[model samples]
Target chain A: MEPKVKSAMQMKIQVRKKKTIVAKDRLFSFLFILPSILAIAIFVYGFIGWTGYVSLSNWNSQIPDFSFAGLKNYVSLFHDFRFQADLRNTAVFMILFIVLVLGMGLMIAVFLDQKIKFENLFRNIFFFPMALSFIVTGVVWQWILNPSTGVNLLMKKVGIEPMWYTSVKVIPGVEWGKIQVGIPIAVIAVVIAAVWQMTGFSVAMYLAGLRAIPDEVREAARMDGATEFQIFRKIIFPLLLPITISVIIIMAHISLKIFDLIYAMTGPGANFVTDVPGVYMFETTFRGNYYASGAAIAIIMLLSVAIFIVPYLLSNRKGES
Target chain B: MKKKWFAFLSFMLALSLLLVGCNSDRASKSGGNGTRLDIFSWWTGAGEEDGLKALIKLFKEKHPEVKVENAAVAGGAGTNAKAVLASRMQGNDPPATFQVHGGAELNDGWVAAGKMKPLNELYKEEGWNDKFPKELIDLVSKDGNIYSVPVNIHRGNVLWYNKRIFKDNGLKAPKTFAEFFKVADQLKAKGITPLALGDKEPWTATQLFEDVLLGTLGPDDYKKLWTKEVSFDDPKVKEAVKTFKKMLGYINKDHSSRNWQDASQLVGKGEAAMNIMGDWAKGYFVNDLKLKVNKDFGWVTTPGTQHSFMVITDTFGLPKGIKNEDDVMKFLSLLGSVEGQDTFNPLKGSIPARIDADPSKYDAYGRLTMKEFKKARITPSLAHGSAAPEGVVTKVNNAVNIFVTQQNEAQFIDALKTAASELK
Candidate 1:
């Protein structure tokens, strides 16, 4: 009985020791991540908070006048002609860019999934543009779409001379209060360039999704005497819905905040036809030194991106649970 | 084991803190013992770079003890450099001396923000009161305090045309709006582009409009527009906008896709007749395109702007918090010197800002402009950020960009009136 009691005492000490070790492990892991957490908190969240404060202040000039002006800057931006155009351009660019990226991505992914010859060569060819930066893409596309030369040379032979990015014709032009609301034809040129550069990313995602689908799904449909088209429509397409949603969310955020490409290629084209919030924010903040208005633009851009991202994250968490 | 892990974590944290501390310390360490002068500008192009290098070489010859860092950011027309400079200044880490446009960009941008120190003493000590033109010096001054030293002056109303194109078409350089249209009609009839405008950046379009404004309102009233002495809603301003629109009708259809250089190239190849740009185009012609100045290209002041010198000067000044004040002053004095201006301006294709600069050192175009600068009514250029604050300039650029496309004169006038509100 004394031996048993001694063993029990030993076990109790072991259990206590184990608890202490677990606490130590937790502390060590926390310590390991503490630096990153601190860096992110200070750099990312801290700067964002500072920017928000600056946006609400009357710091329009180079001097940092942090006097609280409430929503005065935001109110002005909404009334501003250039800012209105920027908002319209961002919306149109986002919708067109996402739809085109997803459509082309799915189509190309399906094509490659057919077990065709030279599949690796095709894949690499499609994926190659993803390696280059948006700046490089903008420059190259600028040359290609130059109204006087490049693609125009070929189009001229066909008796069809589209001015490319130079054209300022807005289709279905309904004059709104301050800005003309329509699809800026010049934006199409930017859209085409953006699609060429980013379609590869969506293609990569869709390809992965395509490969992950069990062959049994397709085989089972075939055994039920379903046509290939029917199998794709009823089974494969629905299965790829998650990837499509992800691609939409990813591409939507990218399109909303696009800057370098438009800046390098068009530069707030004739009548701000190709202008986006990103380009406007940069020029306003850095060039014009309208820091408050620039911060407002930046916040608007952030909200736009969040509109797509927040719901996506929530759904992802829900699905995981 | 737990103790060891904890010790490792502390070591890592300490190492990271040390590294960050070193970085901040290095960034803040400038002009200590070594006396480094960081000379910042956007002069990274072929001719301008050569001019800057030559000027630096001259400075080094005089002050051999000083180390000059050529921190020229390469974007056309200080597009990238201004942003970099703004951030640096706002961070209280300005360079030794940086290039700025002499007028409103210096006065309204830096001086008004309390970022620049007055250079009145430097100008007095250097006897620069009689060196630069009184009107020219006035551009760099605010409330009787000179803020910067003007290094070079670019004439913004110069109309550059291909001599061969003019000769082949039997056209002389137009001296008035009527003459310009006559020549434009002839060029258009011959299937040649009358004006080679590259308005992709919008500033080019604004430049064209400002030139028309100068021509329409003349120098005196044109200067009043920025001062609110002459309103944007005035009939003369509307006439200028109408003239600008008429001029736009003669531009190349592809003007929106090209930058200034591309448009100049059209004229060089004789596909287009004229390009109204600053004298910097002469540098592009002589240096980059390797074209003979007087033989290949001819210049005239933009129609009706013959006696009005649209001054766009590059100046350098002292920022408030820079460490090397004495070194920067030495550099500024060099920039303001006769030999310094001569050594730089010929290579840069701009006339010296100083009235006493040697004419023999300049090219034919430079010599002519130097002579013209003496008698001409010097006016600030709005398109090049001299006449108006950047806020107004940005808005006007937007208005002009829309006007270029929409051609709605009433709307354009309204936009300008709105932009003019920022002047006060």
Candidate 2:
């Protein structure tokens, strides 16, 4: 009976030591993560909070006058003709850019899948532009689209001289205040440059998506009397829905915050045709010294990107569940 | 084995490159007894940057112990520099000295924000009070305290014409708006663009309008417009807008796609007959395009504005919170010196702000402008940030851009009035 009592006492001590070791391990893990959390909290969230504060204040010039101005800046921006035009141009640029990139990316992916010669070389060529920054793209495209000197000069030899960025024409019948609520014709030139740089990303994504589908699925469709086109439509396209949505979300964020390309390529074109909120914000804050107005533009841009992403995320979570 | 060798070679090469980059960065950060003077400006183009470098070389000769940083940030005609300057100033990390236009851009913008130090002592110690013109000194001063020193003066009302085109077509330079229209009609009939306008940046259009306003209101009344003595709704202002609209019709068809440099090229190529730009175009023609001065091109004042000299002056001021005050003051003194002005302005395609600068060292065009400067009435340029405040200029820039495409005269006038009221 004394021996049995000693064995129980030994087991109790072992259990106590395991509990202490686990608590010590938990403390060490917490210590490891503390620095990262502190850094993120101070750097990222701290700056964002400061920017939000600046937006609410009357800080315009060299001095920081943090007097609370409420939503006055937002009210004024909504009434601004330039901001209205910026909204219309951004919408048209985003929609057209996505459509072109997706269509061209899918087409290129399908062509490469045919076992074309030098497929690796073609893939590299297609993906090369993605490696360049938007600033470089804007500068190169600026030279190419120069109305009198660039591609138009060559197009003149072909008896087809199209004004690439010089045209200030817009679609008719929609108007908001003094701003035209239609697609600016000149934005197409900018769209082409943006799409050229970004299509590589979509190509890689879509190609990977295409490769993920099993060869047996296509074989099963063909054996059931489905044609090649029928097999692709019924079997492949639907499978790419998730990837398409991801590409859309990624591109929407880029198009919303675009500044360097538009600033470099076509500055607030004739009557502000090519203006985006990013360019407008830059001018208002830095050049115009309207810091609050510029911050309003920043907040609006963030909200716009959120509007696109939040619904998509909710539905994605629902689908996963 | 070959793949491993290639990878090792690349790793070593990258490592060497990074080491070299870091070495140079450290070198640039230190020198001259640990004293670094940061001089900021927007002079990054070929001729302008060269002129700045020449001035720096002259400074090194005088003070070899002081290391200077040429912080030139270039974009959109100093818009990017101004933004960077604003951020730096607010962050309490102001440069030793920064470029600012004389007049309202300096006093009403920076000094009002309490970022600039009053330079009345510098002016007195250097005897610059007697060197620069009273009008210019007043522009750089606030309430009798001078704040900056002027370096170069670019005449904003200069009209450049292709000499061969005028001589071959049997045409003479016009002096009045009516004569200008007649000359434009003749040139237009001959399939030549009458005016080489590049409004892609919009301020070029505003520059032309400012010249028109000068002609319509005269210099005194024009000054009144800024001080709010005369309103933009005045009938005389309406006349100026009408004249500006008429002038716009004679511009190049592809003006919207071109910047000022591209428009200047039109005159150089003889594709267009005339361009109204600052005398900097003279440098482009003589230096860059290799055209002979007075032989390939000629200049006169813009039509009906010959009596008034529209001046765009580049000046540098000492911002508050400078670490190296003695070095900065020495630099400013050199910038105001006759030797420094002579070294800089001739190469920069501008006349020296100092009246004592030697005319023999300047080009033929520069000599002529110097002679005219001694006698002409000095009127400040509005578009170049001399006559108007920043807020007003921003509004005017936007309004001019809209009017260029919409051609709405009444709307343009109303916008100008709003700009005036907002400035008040």
Candidate 3:
């Protein structure tokens, strides 16, 4: 009976010790992460707050002190024709760019996954454009896209006479009034540059996903008399759904914040048909009017990125669970 | 183990705090000295750098104890530099002295907020009124108080032509609008671009517009149009726009994306007949491109313009919380002095703000402009001058850019009217 009572006491002591150990572990974990938390709170939060405040004021080149203008800046921004045009341009860019980049990236990845010659070499060649800075790439593309200087000249050499080379106006009765678009040359220049830079990143991600497919699974499909096209359509493509989704989210984020390529190619002025939301914010802030409007634009862009990405991330989390 | 981790975190926090403290202390000490003057300007390139270095040397020689820190942020046309300045000023960390064009845009907010220090006392003490021209003094002053020191006067209405090209083509410089068209036609017939123009920068387009307005509608209409005294849709204004549209045919085919300097190069190489640019282009020709003015190039004011030359001047503004009031006074005094103007302006490729300087000491173009000044032929450019504010200028720039590129006259006129209505 005494031995039995001693064993129960010993078991109780062990349980208490285990609880203390876990408490210590928790303390250590909190201490280790404290610095990062503090940094985010101060720098990130502080900057965001400062940006919000500046946007609400009547700030200009000469005005040092900014007074609160409330919704006046936002009102003016809405009234600004340039801002509206930029918003429209950004929307069009986001939709078209995402669709093209994703479609191209997938096709390249699939082609590369096949037992092709110089597989690694081909991968490097496709990815190499990503390494160059957007500013340099934008400049090169601008030269190439210039009607007087670039493709048109090459076309002329080939005896192809395109009317866009000399004419500034769209030819009437052209499909949807599209023939004489002056600014599209610059816009096309930006998209081509962006695609050239971004496609490599997508290719890399898609390649990783493609490589993760099991060799045995393909052998099993073959044993079942599945054709190459049928197997890929039914199996491998479905498996790459997550990677595709991730690419879409990332590309969407990039397209929304695209400023440098557009700005470098065409400066923030009237000739700028490729003006994105970021460039518009810059112009508004520089001109020192309706900073609140600039802030509103920034917040709108942020919300847009979040609206798309949050759902994607949440679904990803659910899938993991 | 947990105690150790807690101690480690505290140590890290302390270390970070110490590092931050050290940095802040260093920054404060650097800025504490009254002798340290943070000077900001948009001077870049080899020629501008050399000119600025010369000016700095003069400044240091006069005040050996005072330290002048150059905060030069160079970009094309001062765009990037101005944006940086605006951001800094908004953050309430303005430089001690910064460069601003003498105009209403410079005065709009700072002067309204009482953030700029008036240089009136310095002007009186230095006898600036007697040294500088009355018109220049008026340009820099607001409500009888001088807020800036006019450093140099740049003539913005000059029409530059390649002398070799003109001579080869048997074309004399145009003295009237009618003759200008004839010269343009002759140049075009000779397989040459009639005008070395880049319309990508709307301000370059505005240069031609202003010159035409000065030639066609004269000075009064120019002022009325800019100051919102007359609507942009007025028949007289339309006439000016139409004349500009006619002149558009003279521009090169590749003008849409060409930089102003590249346009200047076209004329420099005699690929084009003429360029309507400011006298500052002379600096590029002589200093950088190794072309001689009046020998290889010729400059004239647009014809039939009644001797009116568009003049813009750069000046220095003292920020509100300047550290060394005495040093500031000394600097402002020196900036206004005849000796200072003579030393600074010639290097800048501009004439001294002080009219007392001898014209014989200046370059050929300077001497001619000095002669024009003597004849009272100067009229302020509304675009470059203080007639319109910043917002209006940007709007006008946008409208003009679209007009030049698309050639949509009705839309251009409407945009101008809308922009003009916004000026306060």
Candidate 4:
């Protein structure tokens, strides 16, 4: 009985030792991440909160006047002609950019998937633009599409020269409130530049998706007496839906927050034709010193990007669960 | 247990080290005994860069112990520098002395925001009271406190024309709007482009509009527009708008794709007959394009207002929280001195702000402009952020941009009227 009691006491001490070891491991792990948590909490979330507060205040000028102004900055921004134009431009640019990038990316990826000659070379050529920054792309494309000197010079020889970005002509010419509610012709130039720079990313994604698909699926579709186009439409294209969604989400965020490309290329092109909320936010905030109004614009931009990302994130989380 | 404690302690040390590393950069830079003086400006272009280098070289010669750091940001007309300065000012890490446009930019931007120290004492001590023009002094002052010392004055109401084009066409430089249109028509008939313009940034068009306002409203009434004494709805303003619209009709077809320099290049290449720009275009012409002032290009006041000088002065001032106060004051005094202004302006292709600057040090164009600076009524430029705050200037630029595309006079005028509210 004494030996049995001693054995029980030894077992209890071992269990306590195991518990202390587990607790100590957990405490060390938490301590390891504590600095990152604090930094992110203070730097990112704290600054975002401060910006949100500034957007609601009367700190329009250089001086930080924290007096409450309610939604005055937001209200004015909505009514602002430039802001309205920025909205129209952003919507049109986002749609056109996404559609073009997806179509071209899929086509290029499918072409590369074939046992074509120089497949690696073609893939590299399509993907090379991704390596260049938007600023560099904007600058190079600016020269290429300069109304008089660039592509126009060549097009003029063909007896037809489109004005390119210099044209302030809005399509459909539907006047809605302060801005013309249509796709600005100048924005098309920016879209072309953006698409050229970004299509490679989508191509790489779609190619990865294509490569991940088993050879059996395509062979099975062919065995079912399907044409090559039909096999692609029925099997391969459907398989790329996940990739398509990802590309859309990624491109949407980029287009919504695009500042450098448009800023470098056209700079709110004649009458804010190529103006995006990002560019307006920058000019208003930094150049004009309208901090509150700039903050309001920034919030609007965040909400815009969120409109695409939030649902995507939620759906992703749901899928994971 | 020892390993866990060791890991935790190491993690804490690493984080603290990271914090220290981030702070040490700023600490090391600012730890000196006020030896470094950062002179910030957007003077990285051809002639302007040379001017800044010469100014820095001159300062180093005068004060060998004081190190002058030329923090020149390269962008057209301080577009990049202004934003950098704004951020630094907000962070309370201002450079010793920085460049700013004199009037509404310095006064309304920094001084009104309580970021600048009043330079009344500096001006009085340096006897700059009688050196710069009274109207010029009024621009850099608010509430009777002078805030900056103007170094170089750029005339904003200058019309630059290709001398060869004018000579080939047997045309005289136009002196009025009616004459300008006649010349424009003659140039158009001769298959040459008239009034080269690059409104890619929009401020170029706004500057042209401001020149039109000066021509129509006269300098006094033009100044009153900023003060709210003369409403934008005045018939004279409408006339100015109409004249501006007419002038716009003669611009290059690809004007929207180009910048001010590109437009100036059109004139230099003789592809276009004329360009209305600031005298800095002279710098681009002489320094960049290697064009002679009188032989290659000729300048006249924009159509009208020949007696009114639209001044866009690049001034330097002391920010409130800078460490090198004495060094900054010495730099400001140098910028205000006759010798410093003469040395800088001749290279910069701008007239010295000090009326007493030596004329012999200037080129023919500079000499002519300096003479005009003494006699002409000095008016601040709207596009360059002298006549109004930057917000108002941006609004006006937007309005001008819309008008450029839409050509709707009523809408443009209404936009101007709305923007006028911000003038207060």
TM-score of each: 0.96, 0.92, 0.89, 0.96
- Cα lDDT of candidate 1 equals 0.90
**TM-score for chain B of each model, two decimals:** 0.96, 0.91, 0.92, 0.96
Backbone clashes for every candidate come to 0, 0, 3, 0
DockQ of 3: 0.35
Model 1: colliding residue pairs: none
lDDT of each: 0.90, 0.87, 0.74, 0.90
Score candidate 4 by lDDT. 0.90
Reference contact recovery of candidate 3 = 0.27
DockQ of 2: 0.36
Off by over 4 Å in 1: A1-10, B1-31
- For model 4, how does the per-residue alpha-carbon lDDT over A1-321 read when each residue is reduced to its tens digit? 999999999999999999998997797778778888999999988988888999999987777899999999999999988899999999999999999999999988888988799988998999999999999999999999997777878999999978756888899769998888988988988899999989999999999999999999888888889998898888888899988999999999999999999988999988788898999998888777789999999998988899999999999999999
Q: What is the lDDT of residue B13 in candidate 1?
A: 84
Q: Which parts of model 4 are misplaced by more than 4 Å?
A: A1-22, B1-4, B29-32
Q: Which ten residues in a row have the lowest lDDT in candidate 1 chain A?
A: A164-173
Candidate 2 residue lDDT tens string, B229-302? 99998999999999999998999877888889889999998999999988888888888889998899888899
| Candidate 1: Cα lDDT at A138 | 95
lDDT of 3 by residue, B219-304 (tens): 76776675678788888878888888889988887676666787888899888889988888899899878999899999888766
Residue A72, model 4: lDDT of 98
Pick the TM-score winner: 1
| C-alpha lDDT (0 to 100) for residue A207 of candidate 4 | 92
Ranking by lDDT: 4, 1, 2, 3
Real contacts retained, model 2: 0.62
Per-residue CA lDDT of candidate 4, range B56-132, in tens?
99989998889778888887678788889888898888988899998999888899889989988988888889988
